[model samples]
Target: MTELLDQVDWQGKLYSNGWRDASGGVLDSTEPATGAVLGQVGQADAADVAAATARAAEAQPSWAEQTGPARAALIRRAAAILSDNRAEFERWLVREGGAVPGKAAFEVELVLGELWEAAALPTQPWGHLLPTSEPGRESIARRVPLGVVGVISPWNFPQILSVRAIAPALALGNAVVLKPDAQTAISGGALVARLFEAAGLPDGLLHVLPGDAEPGAALAADPSVAMIAFTGSTAVGREVGAVAGRTLKRVSLELGGNNALIVLDDADLEVASSAGAWGAFLHQGQVCMTAGRHIVLESIADEYLERLAKRAANLPVGDPHTEQVALGPLINERQLANVDRIVTETVAAGAEIRAGGNYERLFYQPTVLAGVTTTMPAFREEIFGPVAPVVVVRDEAEAVRVANDTEYGLVAAIQTGSVDRGLDLARGLRTGIVHVNDQTLNNDAYAPFGGTGASGNGSRFGSQSSWDEFTQWQWVTSRKEAHGFPF
Candidate 1:
């Protein structure tokens, strides 16, 4: 892993008209596992941002005028390039993002799939013809690309999260100014720029500015930017949304979630427990859609907790490079401390530590906490760690009630023997996604992916809807026959 990191010049720099050096001071990008400094990432200041945005504005019109199929062809090239570099990307994710092999694999696959999906976007229908009132008049509604889209992507699943917006935005003819999170700046954002460049993308179309929140805030508030697509915590999303709102810039936010993974009384304890452990602990429960709150029916709660505890206790927590390690460390010490704090407070609030909740350095144990209540911090807040708080409910009705009792409406799942009952319960659960006899961690590139309330705001990914976030639908009409109005 160290050899691979050394082989690649990990020095993060601004990518505008091709890769260029940033003028601002440099930040040290360190490995979370060992706290070893990997390399220095050049920071971008306001001047750099202005130059990139100006270039993006200049480049967007020509890109937008190109035929849809022509644009699609370029996206196809990028997808192929991403697929070819899968091994390198996986290693980068492991080192910089702390992704386990399994997590890294999924991230690569998802990125590739979404790129392919974006490749097909330009050829899709932009809008529709509308019925006209007058004869010889044609009315059409067509979606046109926004001029420049400012994409503020989070560190988690950097490749997928960043590409999720970038691919579709570029395919639809909108130029992008990307601001990647500081933690995964080089591993995530810089690699994305490399893929586009290698695939023959025009310079200045996709700019990656690597830094902290200062740059992010500037991007959000830039007057020249046409739209904003952000994926991160709800708190930051709100601030971004506020900045966008002040200017009425087109914005799409995929924010936080506290999803519920419920086990019905009739669920197979064996299958459900395994599914529960994976849903709650995979990637160290760092996913926004992770099932942080496990709502179990009273009849099966004890057995489910017992099985889940055993599995959690055995889950390997160490360096991702090692084969023995199933789970990797948190992205950095800050995240590790936050996760530790939430778990500690939850335990203090009367939650029982049934299994694992220990941590050494950045590594956190896959934890299962029983006797957790709704009022507890672990149950109330988004743990964003490998901690699962099991909440036992009396019946399905109470389970549904407890599931819907959160500010988030991201996702929910019910594991049960009866398909009909599962379907019925799924409908009643208020969430953007509800699964039957499955876990809440499922995601497919072709499906619409988003949430309601705090989870997101009208930016549904996957399928054709991904284009909707980056384009505007305008009603246009033309009169073929010239008509003169007489007094």
Candidate 2:
């Protein structure tokens, strides 16, 4: 087992031997599952943000000039380093993010895969020749990277989300100033820095300045940052988008979700129930794309809820690092309280509590609720925890209506016997990623990942979609002589 360090050792520093305090001292993180102090992270404030931005600005010009293949090589090396240190990386995620060991390992592997995919972006074919009017006229379009990107990643999938944004930004030859969530600041920030260093990347190409919204907002508003990449709640995302928009800086946001799963009357009860429980409860239901608001056919609503409750109860809740533990604590005390309040309020509003709603210590046992309506807060809001509320729908039409009744359009799932019905249901749902007869939470590198409406503004993942997100295009035209004839 890897031993937790009391404090992070700053691998690189300014000209002055002593670390500067533009960001003040440090922020402490505790492992919620065990109530143990994970470690302290160096915090960055407004001054630190400025310094990091300055470094990124200095590094951007030369980096942009380098051929795409050159940057790809560094990213490939970084992927190799990540593969070599998978165990240590997994341990850090489990400690810092309360991720179960298996899920942590899987997420770290996904991050590695994303890094590998991002490397190919450098040398990948881009641009095309376009036809133009007149004999001597010619036109072409080519893609270019945004200079320095300000990335604010969330705590849910700290390792994967941060790496996803950073890998692509770096591969495109852009300098990055990353602001990881305060909860995972120390471990997440330090580990990401190490990966870049191990890959032998340029000194200032990637910098981690872990801080709160102040520095993050400042980064978004900074003139030096050409783009802002953010992943968090819709409320915060909107603020970041507003700031970035004001500055005319390009931005990509993956935000809040009150996603739903529709189970048709003809669906397989066992499979659908199992998928629903896992989708709603995994990562303690902290995923922005979780299917928390379940829309079930009235005919099978009772049966589905019962099976889901049993499956959720079977999941062991204990130390995150234990192999037997399928689920773990909420990220912190605040998250637990928030989840409890939402569930309690829903019950007070006449919703049936199907399973666990009690929180022993910090763990909120996987909760299931029936008799939920779209009007209830738990059903409408993004209660990002281990709570699944099953809302009975009279028919497929009602399911569609209820699923699309939210401000969020992130992801949705539908389980149906008929392919035609499933396709029709998927088309009707307002979500970006739609799953038929299965769970909606799987991460596919080849496919686009993102949301719509308040869920998010753009797509991400190790896909062609991700490539398009961080780039802008320019058109070029040439003519031997003036094309237009004038009288």
Best prediction by lDDT:
1
What are the per-residue Cα lDDT tens digits for candidate 1 across 1-487?
A: 2232343454655677876688776777777777777666768777778888899999999999999999999999988776767888887788888889889999999998988889888998888999989889999999998899999888888889999889999999999999888888777777888788777888779898888878888888888899988999999999999988888898889999999998998999999999899899888898988999999999889999999999998888898876568898898778888999998999899999988889888889999999999999998899899999999999989999999989888999889999999999988888999999889988787898889888888578885787677888889999867789886
Show where candidate 1 strays beyond 4 Å. Answer: 1-12
Question: In model 1, where is the ten-residue run with the lowest total lDDT?
Answer: 1-10
Instruction: List, residue by residue over 174-237, the lDDT tens digit for candidate 2.
Output: 8888888878875567678767776778777787877788888889999999988898989999
Model 2 pairs in collision: 23-45
Please give each candidate's TM-score: 0.96, 0.93
lDDT of each: 0.87, 0.82
User: Which parts of model 2 have CA positions greater than 4 angstroms off?
Assistant: 1-8, 11-22, 134-138, 459-462, 478-487
Q: Number of clashes in every candidate structure? A: 0, 1
TM-score of 1: 0.96
Best by TM-score: 1
